[model samples]
Target: MFPFINRSGTITPRLALIRRMAEFTGLYSWHWTPAEAEAFTSHLRSGPKPIMVSTTRGYEIPIQMFCAYISDSRYGWLEEREQRFGTVPQQVFHEWNTVLHVAEYEGDPRSRPLHYDEVQRLFDAADGRAEQIRARRMKGSVSAIRGAALVKTLYAYAYGLRRQESRGLDLVDLRRTPTNRSWN
Candidate 1:
């Protein structure tokens, strides 16, 4: 009735953590609680060679996905778990326990787009800033104008630029593309 998420990139390491967690906690991973998962991560961090943030996040995702898979209502895993065992599975690996200080911005739901009035207000504010700078006889009128144009362009066309993308912009990026129409 469903397809598996084929999102394994580069490599998908075995869930060797399950064996480790079982050995560490003296319980199977299915029996381990959120606290145990947290402890496991903490243990990794406190080890002689600590893991990186990205690697830690990578570790958490598989465990989290496993819990999610078992607990999903449609899959009948929960029903089977409840019927056979007196317990139901829950998602133990969460934002609080896992690596949140990601070097790259990612994996957030699109929350609340700007309303029509809000969008207009933002563009107006950018334009107004440039006008204000010019009216005050500011030395950086050209910079302010460019800034206003940049803000408008970002909102209107080049939306969803990440921090690194914004920082990586150059004068060449601002150059107009060549039109196919013959200029001769």
Candidate 2:
């Protein structure tokens, strides 16, 4: 019944919700209940990987959509299920049980910026690659060394430049200051 699709013509997130709901409802044979919905949501939150706030919030959308779909009389889901299972599907993802999206940034609390040690390791790895290429006297050793150094510099400054901006940067963008320092 869900004809939802994204701009790319792929199945929308609603399909995943339907599949998960089916699993929880035992192929639509078992009567769907609030407890079952809660259990399903809890199972999702209790996965091995730590659940981010955004991910937890995203999980609610599909369930809410499904609940809305099944509960709406216009969909005829209630009557159809009543005929087959002698029970109507009720909305389970009410505000009381679902997490609300109140904050602008809902990322995982445990996520943080990379440590200096991690950045150092990244540069070391890049340098080691450049050195290896140089040692082998490869044809592209010069370009490889320059590329590695450029990448390390870009990352160190946390420029966060897009592909176009990085590619557009040229010698003209670099300026030498009175302090004998160069800036890009």
Candidate 3:
């Protein structure tokens, strides 16, 4: 049954979860209703790992994929199950019970955005560090200055440039106008 899933044979781990779901629901079959599916999901959610990690990617996605594969006509699972058990497997993880993929940013709250004062403080600290390095005539003052300048440039143009754009920037990418102003 597992061999029919994918060409690569890398679905063993996922198949383990499906087996666990069958055992949890006590159905021992793929032809489970939405109630059983909900129960299975709820059981997984109440597990130890689920308590630590709030996201349902570990439990929900694999179950949903398995249900999709069983319900799909192209896979012939529905026809085969109907012939064997006189029943067809229905999609259990519907919109009502499943989490929706709405937001692009699923990062931590601390990573959201720096406040205006926080940004000012960051720039001040970077500039102060650079100045202190210069005043002390440090051996790696040049590198320190370069890093500070890079930080300032990134912060200044953070609104205009994407993270990759700033990271992939080279010295040649910066153009100096007649007024000695640098533009990326």
The numbered model that scores best in lDDT is: 3
lDDT of 3 by residue, 52-160 (tens): 1225555677888887877789976677788988888777777798765666544456566666798789888877888898898888778877887887788775444
Give the clashing pairs for model 2: none
Rank all candidate structures by their lDDT, best first, as comma-separated numbers.
Answer: 3, 1, 2
lDDT of 1: 0.71
User: Which digits, one per residue and each the tens of the lDDT, describe model 1 over residues 1-184?
Assistant: 2246443442234356555656777865557789988888778767798876566677788778777876789977777777888788788887767778743444332544566698889888888888998999988889988887777666654664566776787766666668422222
**Residue 60's C-alpha lDDT in candidate 3?**
71
- The residue pairs that clash in candidate 3, if any, are none
Report the lDDT tens digits of candidate 2 across residue range 63-174: 6667677678996667777887788767767778777778655675455545679778878888888899889888878887888877875764344456677788775555
Quote the positional error of residue 108 for candidate 2 in Å: 2.7
Residue 102's lDDT in candidate 2: 81
Question: Which one wins on TM-score?
Answer: 3
Off by over 4 Å in 3: 1-10, 51-54, 75-77, 101-124, 135-140, 149-184
lDDT of each: 0.71, 0.69, 0.72
Worst 10 residues of 3 by lDDT: 49-58
Error at 68, model 1, angstroms: 0.8
| Better candidate number, 1 or 3, judged by lDDT | 3
Clashes of 3: 0
